[model samples]
Target: MFLVTDPPEPPATDAFVLEPLRPDLIDLDTEAYLTSPDVIREHSCGRWPVVGFGREDNLPLVIRHWSDHQARRAFTYLFLDPEGTSSLGCLYVQPLFPYLESMGADAQTLLRYAGGATARVSYWLRQDSGPELAASVAERVDEWLRTSWPLDSYLYRATPEEEFTVSSLDRLPLDRVVIDLPAEPHSYLWWSAQVRGGTTRMVS
Candidate 1:
């Protein structure tokens, strides 16, 4: 339910919309984002819930997480079809501190704020959707974020060595920025374009 000032051109499937998750929506979210071990691993960097935990335990956690999102602690969204009945994908948007800390960066690295607010962003969509939809979702959501959030720069992490990832990130106009984080497993790229008043263009 973000207030998009200037929405980007609609995706090929314009029926999709981004919606915030709630307790009642837990089953749908779980089914779409955490259906199986392989699905969880692919989307969550190989981290899954504790062993023996069932949906009963998972539901309450999702409720609490949604509460945190409402409190601005963290943000997560579900990409829903036009009918708003099914989830097509998931997106996570959070500040850079937790990400850096999780990567085992030093305190200074975690504390440093470059430029304006830096938001760490990532997404996971169904492979059946094909590359076009993936790129479309990223672009549309990236534009919405730039307009709706207090962000001046975006930090995107992916294994650039992978051809698919490189193509996906290029859709967002994110270019590689040099940095070293021995503990991190992937390359981090920063968007080198300026997003102002709904338009994005190369800076410098």
Candidate 2:
């Protein structure tokens, strides 16, 4: 089993508030993701709400996030507007070991990299917020993770230009995986079918 450190206090940011993603905030979170631009959705490896995303699709995912946070397996937080009335984006902090394993990294690579890094961090902003807000949030998050979080190193998943690789190992591209899954009704059966079919095409 993968073990992880207890979560740190939500970082204080000048631009927004960070709160644990809970079931009650489902509606706000769902709306934020469903309306996110295709660029944001593509960067999320199709895990974020895609075309045809709905409340029903978000419910279980939110519940799982809540469960995982309670179990300390992973943590998800919503970035709320200053008034705390709605979500602007989301943050995910996941244990490095499991993340690497999921990405099919071999044991040697895991042993070499996971020893120093504690978590893999990623985040996204609402498309309407514009690129300036996104850049600000990214800067603030990087500072928080480097200064406040108790870790020697962490992986920040971003676009190719923004991604900070922790080692010489090339970061795995996720486009094919994202392309294989159907845009609607993101479910296990469809995912399994796509994997077994071994059909893939470039996204561009």
Candidate 3:
């Protein structure tokens, strides 16, 4: 922490911006990262650094701060720089596969791109921040990532063999059993080949 230095004034922009979440060293405290999991405590696939983030004033960061207030821990802020206030985004990084967990099945597959270290960013804004201002803030972030992180750093979707890192589970473990469920209870269990779009079939 920077010892709660003087709050920064609102950044002037026509779009968004992103910053890194470095705990040590002198960080302005504007980095975007996923705070926690909707299910598990963590979604660690590998390691990622703060890459992108955002903040929309209309949807200010009031909720996050409030949650932190309840927990008495610093809330997870986005890497996006809010317009103004003592409020600032705190971004961080993890891995690509974990980030997909938040995006659902279709999104999870995207994790295959993450090769080495990946980054998960967030967007944050103060209660007073607005859309225009937030948009401006978010744009700056995109610009930052374009310049800062190399294309290879965030290739999460790439296979390990391709990127030299096996991300997803390969062969099934002995203890696990696959089950097919139907949308309706009365309906016969509808089994699709490969769970997704593969040829392996458990039920014909």
Candidate 4:
């Protein structure tokens, strides 16, 4: 497990700022989620933002994140515009153990190329932010992770547009895996599994 006695503060740049996700920002968070395209949401979050996901739907998640942050178990940050008036996206930083566990992959095998990295970092930008701004954000975050954080290495999961082979010592490439699930035939999960070429069993 990753443990930090004092987690570093969120990073900021001229293009955007990172702040811990909190209750008061639920409205902005909801708006960000609602405005983001389905593809972007799935790429960033690993699942679709369910239909009609609003402030009410986001409250419990924010609360859970707050608790996790306080416990130093994980960290979730909201990307905000320069003036901090709007949510642009989100960042997630957490230990790699849980991720490997969920994937049912051998830790030793996956960490072979991790270069002693203990944490996994992932982020996404608002689709409407435009390619130029998205590129800037990704570049800035990459620098911040290398310079500001205490960890020397990290497993970086990037969106399709940002994905690249990692040749650097500070970052490691994340290998993708397909998982099979049991879902009722014709259900959304079953459809998703089919599209991803994953096997899904019909639920009685």
Candidate 5:
């Protein structure tokens, strides 16, 4: 018993928009264009917890429909914890779920976003290298990104000539745009989506 009325579309959890986020605020308010007090306390409040996903062959690859478990739509937002943005810290968003429930698409968006993704040398700290040592590299990489992203997208890694620190925020595309929140810095190794939750099946 089969009837081919209309095939079917992909899944909202897939719809996404990557806007610069304020470190002091929670996930994009989808309300205010700038930071909000309520968002800060609810999400950031302080370098609280960071949820990471996707893989970076070079740039962040936002996988559409992260899985069947998620609920809301998501995207990456880069922000700092003091009051500005950081070039070193990368934020990657997961696929949307609600959108799928709405009979939306997941593939086309992922494909499109992937085509537009690319890591631009927005800012970098070359404390180990020298002052502005990354200027050339940044320029080169940014150019490559401008081209590559439109095709398959890309990610850029801090070269050996780059150094990352608090001062790195000074070179953002926007002027002192990011806001930092109060929080105790903690150390946690970044992992992939697969390793995030599933228990390691330590087969003895």
Candidate 6:
């Protein structure tokens, strides 16, 4: 229900940097992932968080998956401070698989929305960080994606447990869908954008 109005600003002095996830860094990332549930509880929508989060038994699997950054399958990033010494948060990006995968659509459906270059993204900032920091990290990574990938538009979605929030293209004629999986109910307030003449813009 809110929107982002201002242009991106330079990151703060203690700004966070995004790095591909790696196995060597799991020990450092443990705390962030473990504490994520509490943070999610406080921040995500419905005020309801997932259970069994932060269980030691799950760390190994979580670490193993994100350890590799597969551009096509998925791109996971660990957010760290400027010094690159600690984990502050994380960001994940991939195609619209999670949102559109079970729709039973044919190739034409994919072409209509993706056209070979649309992406889906998710992110979370440490509970201790200011919301502005989360916004900045999103902007920085978005610009990076624009320059480094073949994307025409990217879809930023709220976690299923959270209320839908959009910025930048909040007022544009954007694509949307509610993913009501039997196990989980969530909505996607997707925003689409395209790069034209060296500038990224909402596709409206």
lDDT of 2 by residue, 1-204 (tens): 334465668865667888889999999998888777565544555555486778898899999999989887788999998888878988987766565566565555566445434566667677677655665666666666656666545555554432222111122222222212222232211000011123333221
Write the residue-wise lDDT of candidate 5 on 1-204 in tens digits.
111122112111111222333333332221121223222223233332223311232121223322211322333343232333222222333332222223332454333223212111223221223334334333333333333222222223222222331233224221221111123132211111111133312111
> For residues 1-204, what per-residue lDDT tens digits would candidate 1 score against the true structure?
222222233233583687776787777776665444444455555555734656687787778768767776666677777787777767776666556666676655555433325667766664445666666676777667666566655665544333344577776655555544668775544443334434433322
Considering summed lDDT, which 10 consecutive residues are worst modelled in model 4?
186-195
Q: Each candidate: how many clashes? A: 1, 0, 39, 0, 16, 1
lDDT of 6 by residue, 91-149 (tens): 76666644464654345445545444566776766666665666566566667655556
Runs in model 6 with CA error above 4 Å? Answer: 1-14, 41-58, 67-72, 103-109, 159-184, 196-204
How do the residues 1-204 of candidate 4 rate in per-residue lDDT, one tens digit apiece?
Answer: 556445777777888889988888888777887787663545544465657677788899999987887787888889999899999988887775555555544545344323323567766667577655666665676666656666644555544433321222123222233223223121111010111123432222
Query: What tens-digit string does per-residue lDDT give for candidate 3 at 31-148?
Result: 2123222101112233322233333321234454534423423223333433432223333223444434444424223433334333433333433334454444434443443344
lDDT values of the candidates?
Answer: 0.59, 0.61, 0.30, 0.60, 0.26, 0.55
Each prediction's RMSD to truth: 5.5, 10.6, 16.7, 9.7, 20.0, 7.6
Instruction: State in Å the error of residue 83, model 3.
Output: 11
Best by lDDT: 2
lDDT of 3 at 71: 48
Candidate 6 has its poorest 10 consecutive residues by lDDT at 1-10
Residue 45: error of model 3 in Å?
21
Candidate 4: lDDT over CA atoms?
Answer: 0.60
lDDT of 2 at 110: 60
Ranked by lDDT, the better of candidates 1 and 5 is 1
